[model samples]
Target chain A: MIEVKNLIKEFEGRVVLDDISANFQKGAVNMIIGKSGSGKSVFLKCLVGLIRPTSGEIRYGGRNFLAMKNREMKRLRRDMGMLFQGSALFDSKTVLENVMFPLDVFSRKNQRERRKRAEFCLERVNLLDAADLFPSEISGGMMKRVAIARAIALNPKYLFCDEPNSGLDPKTSQMIDELIQDITRDFNMTSLVVSHDMNSVMNIGDYILFLNEGIKEWEGSKEHIMDSDNDKLNDFVFASDLFKKIKEADAIITGNEANEENRKKLIQRMEEEAKDL
Target chain B: MTITGSLENIGEYALLMKRVLTPPDRMREFFREFFKEMYKLGVNSIWIVVIISFFIGAVIVMQIALNVASPLLPRFTVGAVSREIILLEFSSTIMCLILSGKVGSNVATEIGTMRITEQVDALEIMGINSANYLILPKITAFVAFMPVLVIFSMFLGLYGGYVICYLTGTPPVSTYVYGIQAFFRESFVWYSIIKSMIFGFIIASVAAYYGYSVRGGALDVGRASTDSVVINSILILMTDLVFTQLAMG
Candidate 1:
C-alpha cells in the first residue's frame, strides 16, 4: 500500500498538483484519470519520485520516500518499475538486452541467469520471438509489450504506467489494459496508472481518481461511475454519445428517472464539447 | 540571472565530480561504456579524420612550397613547416573539427534522443545515475581516442606534405626528411597530444550536457543537437587557445 499526504508541486510558479492526497492499494489497479493538462501525470510522477513534490510525504510500505538518502532512494527505485507514455524502450538495444538492462545494473545474476529471466518475462508479455528484434523493427504495440516486459523483469513492488494506451487502437488498448490488470493481480504489487481513456477506465479501473484542471474531482469504482451524481464527473464521463445512449437506454428499460433539468444540463454540456470538438 | 547561470554551471561541475567518485562497479561500467564508445569513435571516424588530415597537410605544403620561393631558406624548411603545422595546431584543432562533426554530433543526438524519449528518466527511475551511465563513458572515450587521433593527424599531415612536395616539385627526398627532423622537439608533440585530449574532453562534455538538459520532445532534441555542435565548436576553439598558451609555452 502507498499513502500520499498533502502533495503539492509547482513548476515555474504554476501549480500542477495542489495539496492532493490519496491512498493506493496493492493487488488492484489504481487509475488516475483527467483531461489533458489536468495533473494526472504529475501526480503519478510525484508518487514514483520522478518529480519531487514541493511539499508532500509519500509512504510506500511505511517508509517515507521523500526523505530517503541517495542510497536509500536507489534501493527504493530498484523496487520500482515504470512504463512511460512513449514506451521508452532503448532504440539501440534489442528487446532481450532491454529487459536485461535492469538486471545488469542491479543484480549479480550471471549471463545465463539474466537471459533466462529476460526470456521468461518476454514470454509472459507474449513477445518471446521478438527478443532479438530492435525497438525500431517492432510496431508501437509490440514496443509497449517490450516495455511492459522490461518493467516487470525485476518483479518490482511498485508499478507506475503513464498513458500506456496513448496511441494504441481500441482493441489493442483493451488487451494492454487487461495485461496490466492481470500483472497487478499476479504480482500483487501496488499499481498506479494514469490515463483518461474511458474504455480503460471502465475496463481495468479497480479504483479511479478523477481530476479536473489539477484538483481531485471524484474517486470511485467503475460500478459506481455510471450512477455517480458528481455533476462535473458525469458531464466529462457520460459526455460520450455512446455512454449517453446507454444511460438513456437504461432509463427507458429500468423506468429509472433522471430529473428533467439534469437531463437538459447533460445534453447542454455534450453540445458545448461537441462544438469545440 | 547571471548568478543562476553560474550556479547551474557549478551544479553541473559538482554533479560531474560526484559521478566520477561513484562506486567501483559503477565506475567500471562507465569505463566499459567508454570502451564501446571508443570502438565506435575509432572505427567510424578513421576515414574522415585521415582524409581531412591529408588535405590539411597537402594544403599547407602547397602554400609553403609555392610562396617560400627564397633560395636562401633551407630546402629542408618544408619539413620544418610541416612539422610546426602538425605539432602546433593541425594535429589537435583540425582533428577536433572532424571529430566535432563525427563523434560529437553522434553523442549529442544519442543523448538528446534519450532525453526526449524519457529513456534518461527511465534510468533515473531505476536509480542509475544517467550522467554516470551516459556522459562519463563518453568523456573517458574521448580522452582515450583524441590523443590517438592527434597522432594519426600528425602522421597523415607529414604524409600529405611528402605527397604534395613529391607531386608538385620533385623536391629531394633528403630535404623533406631533413625538414621533418629539424627543430622537432618532444615537448611539441606532447603539447599537441595534451591539447587534443583536452579538446576531446570539452567537446564530449558540452555535447552531452546540452543533450541531457533538453526538455519537451523531438523538436527539443533537434535544437539540443544543433546547440551542442555550435557550443562545442566554440568551446573547443577557446580551450585550444588556453591549452596552447599553457602547454606550448
Candidate 2:
C-alpha cells in the first residue's frame, strides 16, 4: 500500500496539486479521475517522484519515499513500473527488445533467461507474433499492449499508467482496462492509473479518487460514483447521455418503483444500451 | 535573450553535463550503445566527408594556382597553400561546421522527439540516468572517431589536389607533390585532429542539450534542432579561433 499525506505541488507561484491526501491499496486498480487541467497527472507524477511535491509524505510500504537518498530512491524505483500516455517504447528497438529493456539493465538473469522472460511477457500480451516488429510498425492498441508488457516484464510491485486508453477505440480500451485489472490482481501489485475514461472507471476501478481544480472533491468506489451527492462530481459523471440514462435506471431500480424481475430487466437494458453506444 | 537567461542556460548546460558524464549503469549496455553510435555518427559520415573534401580540395588548388600565378612566387605555392588551408581550417573547422548542421540537427531532432514523447521520462522512472544513457555514447563515439574523419579529410584533400594538378598540369604534378612535402609541419595535422575532437564534443553535447531541453511539441523540437545547429556552428568557429591562436602564437 501507498500512503499520501497533504501532497501539495506548486509551479512558480501557482499551486497545481493542492493539499490532497489518499491511500492506494495493493492488489487493486486505483483510479485518479479529473477533468483536463485538474491535476490528475500532476498528482501521479508527484507520487512517482517525476515531479517534486511542495510538501508531502509519500510512504511506499511504510518507507518515506521523499526522504530517501539518491541510491535508495533508485533502488526503490526498481519495484515501480510506469506506462506513459504515448506508450514510450524505444523507437529504434524491436518489440521484444522493448520488453527486455528494464530486465537488461537491472536483471541478474543471463541473456537466454532475459530473452525467455521477454518472450513470455510478449506472449502474455498476445504479441509474440509481433515480437520482431518495431513500435512504428504496430497499431496504437498493439503499442499500448507492448507498453504494458514492457512495464510488467520486471514483475514490478507497483504499476502506474497514465491515460492508457487515450487514443484507443472503445473495444480496445475495454481490453486494455481488463488487461490492467487482470495484471494487478495476478501480481497483487499496487496499480495507480490516471484516467478520465468513465467505462474504465466503472468497469475496473476498484477505488477512485476524484480531483477538481487541484483539490480532492470526492473519493469512492464505482459502486458509489453514480450515486454521489457531490454536485461537481455528479455534473462531471452524468454529463454524457449514456451515463445519465444508466443513472436514471439505477435510481428507478433503487427507488420504490420496481420488483426484482423489473430491476434485472432494467440492468439488462442498460447494458444493451451501453453496448450499442 | 537577457543576460540572466543566457547565464541560466549556461548553468543548466553545465549541470546537465555533470549528469551526462557519469559512469554508465551497465558497461555491457554502454559498449553496445557506444558501437552503435560510432556506426551511426562516425562511420556513416565518412562518405560525405570524402566527397566534400575531394571537391573542396580540387577547388582550393585551382583557385590558388589561378590567382597567385606570378614570377616571384614559387610554382609549388598553390599546392602548399591548398595543403595549409585544408589542414588548418577546411578539413577540421569548416567540416565540423557542416557536420554541426547535419549530425547536430539529427541528434537534436531524435532526442527532442524522445523527450516530447516521454521516452526519456520512461528511462528516468526505471532508475536509469536518461541523459547519460542517451547522450554519453554519442559524445564519446563522436570524440573518439573524429580524429579518423579528420585524417581521412586530410588524405582525400591532398589526393584531390594531387589529382587536379595532374589533370591540369599547369604547375606540373611533380612540383605540386614537392610543394605538399615542403614546410609540412606534422604538428598541424595533430592540431587539426585535436581541434576537431573538441568540436565533435561541442556538436554532440550541445545538440543533446537542446534536444533534452525541449518541452512543448513537434514544433518545439524543430526549433530546438535549429537552435542546436546554429549554436554548434558558432561555438565551433569560436573554438577554432581560440585553438589556432594558442597553437600558432
Per-residue lDDT tens digits for candidate 2, residues A1-277, read 9999999999998999899999999999999998999999999999889999999899999999999999999998989999999999999999999999999999999999999999998998899999999999999999999999999999999999999999999999999999999999999999999998899999899999999999999999999998788999988898787897776666665765534554666679878989999
> Which pairs, if any, clash in model 1?
none
DockQ scores for all predicted structures: 0.74, 0.87
**Residue A166 accuracy (lDDT) in model 1:** 95
**Taking the tens digit of each residue's C-alpha lDDT, what string does model 1 give over B9-95?**
659866765774455345545666778888886666778878989998888877777788588987788778878988788888878
Q: Which candidate ranks first by DockQ, i.e. highest? A: 2
TM-score of each: 0.94, 0.96
Winning candidate number (TM-score): 2
Clashing pairs in 2: none
Cα deviation at B121, candidate 2, in Å, is 0.2
List the candidate 1 regions with Cα displacement exceeding 4 Å: A259-277, B1-17, B20-28
